[model samples]
Target: MTIFGEIAQITLRALLGRRRTLLMLLLAAIPILVGLLVRANARPGPVDVGAFLDAIVIRVVLPLVALVFGTAALGSELEDGTAVHVLTKPIRRSTIVLAKITVAGTLTAALLVPSTIVAGMLIAGLLNTRPGSDPITATFAIGLGVLVGSYLYAAIFVALSIVTSRGLLVGLGYALIWEGILAGLLPGSQVFSVREYVRGIAETLEPSSIESIVGSSAVAYAAIALVTASVIASLRLAVYEVRGGE
Candidate 1:
């Protein structure tokens, strides 16, 4: 196996072999459960389903999941002093950081994508809800949006792990306070919010129906540029920290 593959395997094991994994699984299931409840309560239309997904899955669950997995990907290793052993290897620090963030991002996507799809599909069925667009297409688009957001969040939180041992606390604060509250209240701050990026991507995909609820003003190219920049900057910071420890 390649060095990146080896590091990713170790990261996967480290992340999955914990009680927190179970908690994350439960967390991922929350949207599906809520979808079931919504279906039971009332026959919600496409717009309502889109709004529910935007409010619950995109805004709340995605960040929380990414925060947990992303920080734990490297944070636990550093805290337990196991990362020093990996650092001692004849491997590039960039490779280590890349592998760690990739694993973290992929895991976050894997858990949330299906959850988002199922919840959206359950709330808005495979049938066409309107003339041009369908809930199924919008649902899959949102799932892809979650996939994009997961990697961005993972990269940011992985770098946070390197910068501080309190990565979880710091990430949680950023998600809940900065992105959740400040971004909502201060419209200009939406430029710095990953939630807004996700909304932008999703709105771009299913523009006709989801635009009203997702309410993102960011253009697709700008959102892509911001996400790409964040990921590169995050990986650079993580690599620098790892190399500085040498």
Candidate 2:
């Protein structure tokens, strides 16, 4: 296998081999279970389902899962002193950081995207419905949003891991305190929250509705630009840190 492939394989094994993977699986299941309950008890409409997805899955679960996987991708290696061995290889530091973040993002998307889609479908009652409908389109829009959020969160957390040994705790604080509390309470803080960006993308993709609970098209465009910049900046920082060593 190629060096990138080898690094990705090792990262994947390390991530899945941990007991924490079970916690991640449980986190991924929350939306699905909530969907079932909503479908059974509330008999929710599309708007209700969309609101639930925006509030719970995209805003809360996506960042949390990404935090776990992203920090652990390289942070665990660094913490346990295993990363020194990898650093001694003849590979470019950029390549190592890229491989680790790629694996982290892929795994995050794998776990959360399907869960988001299944929950949206269940809550919107799209299982037996035909394609090309608004509900189906909306359900898919949420899935797409989750996919984008996964990568963005992974990139941010992976960079954090390179900079600090306490990446997980720091990521949790960012997720809960900054994104969850401040962004919701403060007027302008949503501009800095990854959750808002994800919600903007979903709202932009879904069909227009008066009851839309997420962001506007302007926010979506901003999200695209900001996410691109964040990913590039994060990779650059991670590469620099890896090259500099501890």
TM-score of each: 0.86, 0.83
How does model 2 score by TM-score?
A: 0.83
- Model 2 residue runs over 4 Å out of place are 43-47, 126-133, 207-246
Clashes of each: 0, 0
Model 1 steric clash total:
0
How much lDDT does each candidate structure score? 0.79, 0.76
lDDT of 1 at 32: 97
Q: 1-246 in candidate 1: lDDT tens per residue?
A: 999899999899989976878998999999999988877766334345567788888889999999999899987788877888887788766778778879989999999999999999887763434556667778887898889888888888887887787999999999999987888788577777888777777877877435532355544544564456456645554454443454
RMSD (Å) of each candidate, 1 decimal: 3.6, 4.2
Query: Which of the numbered candidates is closest to the native, going by highest lDDT?
Result: 1
